[model samples]
Target: MPQNQPTNKIQNPETSVPKTPEMNERDFLNDMLTTEKYMTGSYNVALNEASNQTLYQDLATIFKETQDCQRNLYNLMFKNGWYAVDQAEQPKVQNAYQQFSGYKNQLPYAVQ
Candidate 1:
């Protein structure tokens, strides 16, 4: 509780589990989340390289579903405090925005 410490962390109470070698709910969910992430990445590659229109559409649908599942798993883990992320500082965010703001002008097409 100091001014120098960051205050933007958002988390829920973490569920307690045994520390033994046995797998727990958190472990299973974490595994599944990792699998989903990998699947989504593979699907993205397939979608990009798809040659047939029909296959591309099908892959796109499956990609969206896989992405959604990944998001849900992430949300569940975050809600259970299994996942933690630091919020970006306002000044740093503004700095990044300012740094990127001029790049839009370099684009070939007009943006709005």
Candidate 2:
């Protein structure tokens, strides 16, 4: 292992905005993103517990729309540099792949 590993981050230049007690564009978008996430989770639970086929289908459609909205909001935020993620190290990613690969043999159905 190398003593020093360079950290990688994915981000863009953030749009400038004044910081104040009042909500700004970033704050509003952040709040909407959070709400969308919560709504998606709720819809997922509702879909799982839905008993009627029609209701399940309706909820599924709504869930997909909500998920899409969430993704768009996330993309917007990321583009504005409001959302940043660290790039995974290659060795760690390979280790995770190897660990999960072993579990494939335990699955009931064959993977092909």
Candidate 3:
């Protein structure tokens, strides 16, 4: 005869400890879907609890700014034909200004 057992640990009346990390079904899933960072396992969802939401938001903003900088750099190089390995060392102040101007004018409201 086969034996039946409780797979999860009963932490308390309020919470159940999952048998495995992968078995956790809440918080991690929320993080993946909503770009919301999780405090614990996938299944452990935060119930609008008090936490540092601003810190995560700031991190997201920083990431976006970094992406924007990279895009601007690529566009600048493209417009000026700055294809050389030592492009930055080469004196092309006028080209830089023109490239920056083009990027500035086109970038706002530009869809990905």
- Candidates' lDDT values, in order? 0.91, 0.92, 0.45
What does the lDDT come to for candidate 2? 0.92
Per-residue C-alpha lDDT of model 1 across residues 1-112, encoded as one tens digit per residue:
8999767877788988778799998999999999999999999999999999999999999999999999999999999999888788899999998778778777789484
Model 2 misplacement above 4 A: 1-7
Q: Count steric clashes of candidate 1.
A: 0
For candidate 2, the clash count comes to: 0
Q: What are the TM-scores, per candidate, against the unseen true structure?
A: 0.88, 0.90, 0.27
**Quality of model 1 by C-alpha lDDT:** 0.91
Q: Identify the leading candidate in terms of lDDT.
A: 2
- Model 3, CA-based lDDT: 0.45
TM-score of 2: 0.90
Q: Sorted on lDDT, highest at the top, how do the candidates line up?
A: 2, 1, 3
Q: lDDT tens digits, residues 30-79, model 3?
A: 33423422222221322234267785565556655555554555444434
Lowest summed lDDT window (length 10), candidate 3: 36-45
Task: After the best TM-score superposition of candidate 2, give how far the Cα of residue 32 lies from its true spot, in angstroms.
Answer: 0.3
Inter-residue clash pairs, candidate 1: none
